[model samples]
Target: SDIFGEIFGGGRGGRSTVFRGADLRYNLEISLEQAAHGFDTKLRIPAMATCESCKGSGARPGTAPTTCPSCRGAGQVRVSQGPFSIAQTCPRCHGSGSIIPHPCAQCAGSGRIKLQKTLSVKIPSGVDEGDRVRLSGEGEPGVNGGPPGDLYVQVHIKPHPVFTRDHDDLHCEMPVSITSAALGGEIAIPTLDGSAKIRVPAETQSGKTFRLKGKGIKGVRSQAPGDLFCHVVVETPVNLTERQRQILREFDAISQQDSARHNPRAKGWFDKVKEFFES
Candidate 1:
């Protein structure tokens, strides 16, 4: 049996036709702050659109298409092979069940042409890296009377410099001068918005974390802003002059006279070690 033939073995033709189209994809990159806050961008895409000259009819100017003679108006043809009788697509009409003797010059017989379209896309807040922003009905145009496909926009966020972000909290290292750590003073700390001063207590130790409330990123779903954690790193004295070195040595000598008074923990630990040896 042939692919196309006269329906009911009479005038040429068939039943209904099936048409499908193609889909499109795009990649978009945004900043971390933009992803956290949300923004809109424009996208230019190349796709196929229905031919204007033929208005998607695919017929020549001033000429109309004729119903397929092989499949009548149905689009499918029935054939008998050996002991089997089955339905096949009509070749003459290519399942469209119509024929244009004088096809449109612009699109030939396809009914669509290449074009470029610019579209605006909106980005939602709190969308992290590798997130996808979908735009429905924004892909390539459909084929021969079929529905159009979809467009997908994949998102990527750039890295920040000063602060490191976790889920919502921001982490940063803050250096404190030796005097600030020992005698206690105000030290400036960095935040997303601006610099802030934190009071350092006397004898403050290194690796202590100070939290600033409402200073970190605020997600779209969060009720309150996340916290900013500042880890203190005590800075040692450098470029000491001869007089400064002598003063430091005298201070150390005074503290060493009574270890039990200046360094009670060290004296207690040594006593415990001696007792352990005797036992």
Candidate 2:
């Protein structure tokens, strides 16, 4: 039976004659910070492993398998009807050329069992969404002494609260009060590392973008750090007190007295509208 099993290129009911292990994939979700900076994490996955009790032989203790007699250890049998001969796998041994008389109780003659495995994965810096980390030989157990498949860990970055990423650059909106826009001042802005001060120029209008060099994320393939763009948005005062409202009204009256100097953009826009209407 041993010689016949060797001749048939099949193990003695220990391994599969034809099938290889299947690869596995797992999705790992991480924060934007973790994606920007490398992180180490552990994953618990359910997978197939070789049965310890059977030792991947599919036979009970102290027992051995015998070659199939149905196909004379050939793994396949021939059927003839009139003019043609059809070759088919022997149903008794399922083309393994061997049969396990006493099956292992743990794996139920499958030579493998489902188990939970723990694997540590390292996520590199600047890994974006859909990037995969391959762990070699960490997948399902192979059959017929073949090599195990690989495990792929897919990355998914969570949405950031303040910044939006574009390649290596970061963009965010900074809200400035009306007073800060009117009178130049320094305001603290958030960055990846920490907060930085940005100068708000006098009479700075809304939608003005300011770039901070080397304040963005550094990619894995990038030579230098990217910049951070801060778009200034002038916020209108809300919930104003009666005294503040009166003061604003007085200021508005004064501002209207010198509209060309105080509000040149508004005056120019009005002039353009007046010209268009007259023409």
For each candidate in the order shown, give its overall lDDT on alpha carbons.
0.78, 0.86
- Model 1 lDDT per residue over 171-234, tens place: 9888888778889999888776779988989888789999999888777567777899999999
Displacement of the residue 240 alpha carbon in candidate 1, Å: 8.9
Runs of candidate 1 exceeding 4 Å displacement: 1-23, 64-73, 79-81, 90-94, 99-101, 144-147, 175-185, 200-207, 233-279
Leading candidate by TM-score: 2
Kindly list the per-residue Cα lDDT of model 2 for residues 211-279, writing each as its tens digit. 999998888788887899999999999999999999999999999999999999999999999999999
- Return the lDDT, model 1, position 199: 90
- Listed in order, each prediction's TM-score against the native is 0.65, 0.86
Task: Mark the 10 consecutive residues where model 1 has the least summed lDDT.
Answer: 9-18
Top lDDT hit: 2
Off by over 4 Å in 2: 1-19, 270-279
